[model samples]
Target chain A: MPRENPLAPVERELRVAPRHRLDLVNEVDADVLALQAELERRGYGPAEARRAAVARLVPGGRVIRQLEDRHRPLLGRRVLASGWMDRAVAVGAGAAAAFAGVVAVVATASPGGAGMTAAIRWLLVFVAALMAANLGRAAARLWVQGDLRQEERQLLWARQTGLIVAAVAAGALGAAWEGYPVPGTSVGAGGPAFVPQSAVWEAIGSVAGVAVVGLAVAVFGLFGWLLVTPRLITDEECERRIDDFFAQSRPRLTPDSTKAQSHAQ
Target chain B: MQVTLSKRINELLVLAVLDQGPAHGYQIALAVEEQTGGSFSFQHGTLYPILHRLEADGRLRAEWHGTGRRRKTYEITGAGRAELAAGAAELEVQFRALLGLLRGCHAA
Candidate 1:
């Protein structure tokens, strides 16, 4: 007699079972299809709709929660009441930047102002330090939330590290520009004429400085925009987004299929 | 106008849909949307959890059926029907009260 197939019994049981829980694979596929259809109905092209559908299904993490929370205080609140604090902060930052710019210009215009130059240098360092501290605090909060997976945590750490490194590089370039030595040219003369090597370092340092300033300006603009923009999502919308994320991210398995597969193995 | 459904109202909506007969998730969603004149769109995340919760509470029964790919369908229980009736009554009372207030405002 031929050896009996061990998989036969499990397959039989699966066939006999009247009801089974919906497995994750089918669940995700159905949800994605539904989302895609909905998005397409809203005038998104097929590709764009699919991409959006996938993004909606991504698993929830600390980063996502943080982003969602950033919008929460504005939701369902009176516009004036919800935004006053952020508007105040943005106005204060703009004033500080304007004051710093004026001070730097005045210090540069002063005659034989070695001291003023030193103060300018200190100001740059102070700004860099402030940026670093703020970035670190934000990163720390994200970490403390502890909802991130290992990969997400690593990605966040890598991004923060890159920003810190860039800030340090910018600060160093600024300092180098301030102290760049003059190169001596031997013109037939009473003394060697020293030309300040500020041109090259100044260009490089200015680029870095502009980049940092632009980032700060962009952040301030974002804050202002957030303060002004009406709330985009209701509580139901938020809950829906969160649910889609989890539904997409979590693993799905059916018991009977697993048993059947295992028996076949 | 878009009507925002509270959690209880959403639950009642699901129960009312199932009261017609057994229906799969997608079908139920379609039914609700159609009944509301496309004003109500239920996301999978919102709908599935509610269905599972109802099943867990013995207010609904879920069974999988299909040949190639299984689909989970739900049927309303007696408890679910009772809850639906109570919710509809409550909603009717509140809606009438609001309507009366609006009429009073118009009179004033």
Candidate 2:
């Protein structure tokens, strides 16, 4: 059977292992130790320092969960600190970049003598934007989960795939733009004929259009991941905190399983 | 009751320290003690583990560089910054409510 997470303590007041003693940890981890010291500095008691030490050690989500499990009854501050807003920001950025790519493509594709190749250049720009947005989101998720997610891992790989495709398409576009030389007019024994110069904007538009597609892929892929994944990773750190804080207090109630599981990214 | 109050206060204090900039486990300890007039001092040994834990949780991140010889530095992440702000705001609300509660009887 699956074991209980070590971080999943039965009691909210549970502490860390003796070897991971608060006093011992305080001496080594300056940031939190400073926090513990400040408690003692402010004349707060040892127990208070210890509890705060644990809170500082764990992610805010875990700490908040622990507080709630204890029936602390107050949660506004903790919720805000979990950084949910930042996650939303990442999603929004991705969507906007994808939308821009689409617009570029349409402008390039227009038939009134609009140059497809020029539009393609604009598409490249959109592709770059798409890449940046996805990368940003991935980085945020990595930090949020304190690890990588399967979908995000896939997205990362797809990024490499995307690069290859872009390179090939760019090469083709370059060849077409330079080789054709904009329908150059030439004198022939047959008769005079009009040759239209390649429209720079048309190429720009085509590139932009292609970029839109790339952005769409990024947006949809991220969206699918968001939809499919339980989204447990974002809360993983907090969950660990919850498990640990409670587990330490009620040792017999639940065995610490986090030690056995390398669940976090 | 005191434990609850103290935990909130401690979080506030440490975050306030970080607001100044990032510091290592040792530096944070020193800063906390110094800021609190030595009334507070961590065991020094215990601080590192806690900092590691924080880093694990995304509240802080580590930056290792070759400084003179060897030393690792730590800084708060954006999430940590947000947490600090949230914590401060909560404390402010609590303090205000507490002040009002304390003053109500006298006013009446």
Candidate 3:
């Protein structure tokens, strides 16, 4: 014979109320009964197991705050690790994409010259801009999520602002200098002469480009390095350190003779 | 006797319970309470978050089962089992130190 549903009446009643705490309580009670049975099977005495099951019968709201507080530190560590891993992966993928772009530029430049150079320059600018935007977003997210004090947050913001201002000034200066005429280049009677620019300006542009790329590389490399370095202090070690710190601060009783000597002094 | 649940110990307990076989959230909580002889009480809200975190860490696999009232069932992975063993060892060391501290306090 098919077993009758014990909760049929409760379900019907729930249909009328729809969103009631009483329905939640009933569901929790059922779960507690199931837990009690499992506890008995594991060799806990019936009364003791029932007590444990009953403890969970309280409304979830009352206990959630305590649970979150207890687990916050552990959760924080996990979040930090996850964020670092994400940054490392993003950096790795970005580097690979940049390398592919360079290869494509080389292949395309072989067929055409002036037009290709201009296209490549624009492509480079686009890639650099995209990379900067991505880094900015990542840094902002990290700062927002971080459990930093007010002063630390202000310091970080200032440093980031300085970095942005410096980068913009350098880029603007480089762009302006890039359009300067070559030292020997002059206009011919028929048309303009195509003389290669001064080695000095070319060298400066090369240095500027290298500096920008190097900065990006350095930032990504730091994150990648952190990802690979084995953790010096595991959770267990941290716990032990905390315990030891407390133990050291705990008051100790001196010997009676020592106490007397101190009192006499 | 009521005992505060250590996050590390609670994780091991969850993994250990699932090691027996695949089980749902309520069942895991039951097994943990029973095994600890009611000393450790874990609420549904507390257990679910830990389960979700363990799943994210790839220590456990979760799948929704049942109809109408869908239930989430969990199973331990190899990584979880390895972690349980490591946690047990670490707990042993912690307990030993704690016992010594308690004994010294009593003597003093």
Candidate 4:
């Protein structure tokens, strides 16, 4: 009674190889979500969005490849490794700063040009340490996170760190060369105790100190922003999103039409 | 012993599963489970999407027919068969190489 079956079933089930299959359905789903978001932003309706999304994936174009590469396992792994490296550098720099500060404070308190030289040397070392740490953090975010937003935040932080440290280092070095106790009120002296400080060296050190302080203030203000943007998407969130993606992608990835129908139910 | 297959290797498994016979969706899913001794399971929701894409890409062909009730059946295309062959050969080479490495490690 029914029309001759259009499709005849083969006697044997097709065989699949163990290799060359990846549980990347979730990753593909993420791409679809991203694509959908883009389409919505562009004012496309849901139906149009889906059609376009399929078109984007098929015909062997590199479009899907580019999207897939973004969510690659290797990319996530690299991001995690970078985070570890950044944290390590940050800790090391903090330690170096503490060491340098202690040395500078102790050495600077004593009298003579030698004390000033030591202070300057210690300041230079401290600043260099801070710069290195900031650079490490920036590098980690840029290369590992693969998030442009995070990279920008790190870049800003690094720039401020560099500026502040450079000022501190230059101020200390100049003061040492000038052979003067930094021009501030001496404990017993009256009338702001000029202390016969050279106008040129004093002016250089003052400018450098002011610049460093300014940089520190800028970095402090921006610190909150750095924490807010580009958060490390947690492992749980990653897993959940990946799961959702696979679920949505099942219809397209599966070949047996009947299976897709059953699953859709 | 049950071997662990990762998500990355699941696509190959799908092809392998289909190779057993011309099965509708659920049947192939069952076959995969049976052959792998319940070690490997296909997610119904995810599997269909892959199947549709494979059909669209000409790796598989789908036909709608009525057998008392309406149902869709899919079969691998020539292209799909070729792909399976290539995939199998590549996997065999990899497995042998991995086995050699594992044996060497055990010897050490």
TM-scores for every predicted model: 0.34, 0.32, 0.35, 0.32
DockQ category of candidate 1: incorrect
Q: Residue A142: error of model 4 in Å?
A: 8.1
Residue-level lDDT tens digits of model 1 in B1-108: 343457678888899999999876655766787799977656523565567668867899987555444445689999999989988998999889989999999999
Ranking by TM-score: 3, 1, 2, 4
Question: Candidate 3: where are CA atoms >4 Å away?
Answer: A1-59, A62-265, B1-5
Candidate of highest lDDT? 3
Tens digit per residue, CA lDDT, model 3, B1-108: 343448777888899898898876677775787798998757634675577678878999977543332345689999998988888898899899999999999999
The sequence of per-residue lDDT tens digits that candidate 1 reaches over residues A66-149 is 223322233212333455646644654665556457545543443323543345444543444444444333332222221222
Q: How high is the lDDT of residue A58 in model 1?
A: 25
* Isolated chain B TM-score per model: 0.83, 0.67, 0.87, 0.75
Worst 10 residues of 2 chain B by lDDT: B64-73
DockQ scores for all the models shown? 0.09, 0.07, 0.09, 0.05
The DockQ assigned to candidate 4 is 0.05
Better of 2 and 3 by DockQ: 3
Cα lDDT tens digits, model 2, B14-72, are 66677788765555666787899988655413344345555666878877543221235
